[model samples]
Target: MVSTGITPSGIFHIGHIREILTGDMLTRAALDAGMEVEMIFIIDTADPLRKVYDFLAPEFENYIGHPIGAIPAPDGAGKPSEGGNYGEHFLSPFVEA
Candidate 1:
């Protein structure tokens, strides 16, 4: 199995989306296309630097540790914030797209 990780350091933002989901999506498509494929999603929570991500999004800093990347926005909104969820932040583009 091929393994990959989307490191959640600081403002991971676009890079995170590209790695975990987008990359996996490509792998899945390749597999369907008859290519040998194995995908492993790794949440690299061991890095000391990741501790700093909380600082970047201080509003959510208290949620540090437990599966942080998926931590629900404090208000159940759809976007993320230093202060929002992914959707609330990108609702504009999402609507257009």
Candidate 2:
């Protein structure tokens, strides 16, 4: 098994992609080498909202240390998601990618 983890605390940067891609490439290479491989990805939706992001309103400061999945979306993307959680909001795009 090949495992990679991401904590959606802020922007989805190139470093995040690099880790995922590395794991994926390793998994694929193992498969090609006649080995069975399972790709595992860990999304840390429960990570805390540590600080108020530049894009977020100052009110978000009140949510510091709260689980990201329990907080509202900073951008008010929509219902459920708007109030869904921080990590998942950012995580969706990474999953699609």
Candidate 3:
């Protein structure tokens, strides 16, 4: 099954870690219980209507292709990502999965 979240809590949050941990925990449990599982995560940073037709600078304006981890982050809590460029952040997680 496909599960999706908009990540409204900004790019930097324990919420991100929790969502990932939850997905991993459940997937493992599903495996032990003999179930096939697939997981997908979308940053949802590019929704037009959510933009209210406006772009968030450094984010919508200049941060395209960056992963949620590497950007300036919604709160600057840290670098938050191991990615080097925007494209890596946007595509790497699923690539590894």
lDDT per model vs. reference: 0.50, 0.80, 0.47
What are the C-alpha RMSDs, in order, of all predicted structures? 7.4, 3.4, 8.1
lDDT for predicted candidate 2 compared with the true structure: 0.80
Q: What residue runs in model 2 are displaced by over 4 Å at the alpha carbon?
A: 76-82, 95-97
* CA displacement after TM-score superposition, residue 48 of candidate 3 (Å): 6.2
Q: Give a tens-digit lDDT track for model 1, residues 1-97.
A: 5567754444446666677776688788988899998888775544332342423445554555544434443333322445443223323342355
TM-score of 3: 0.43
1 versus 3: better lDDT goes to:
1
Q: Evaluate model 1: give its TM-score.
A: 0.42
Q: Per-residue CA lDDT of candidate 2, range 6-92, in tens? A: 889777999898888999999999999999999998887787888777777777878889988788776653223345567777887
Better of 2 and 3 by lDDT: 2
lDDT of 3 at 66: 46
lDDT of 3 by residue, 1-97 (tens): 5465544323345666677777777777887888888777666544322231122343444444443344543223223333353324434454475
lDDT of 2 at 41: 88
lDDT of 1 at 85: 35
Deviating ranges (above 4 Å) for candidate 1: 50-97
The true-versus-predicted C-alpha distance at residue 21 of model 2, in Å, is: 0.4
Q: Which regions of candidate 3 are displaced past 4 Å? A: 6-11, 48-97
How much is the lDDT of residue 54 in candidate 1?
A: 28
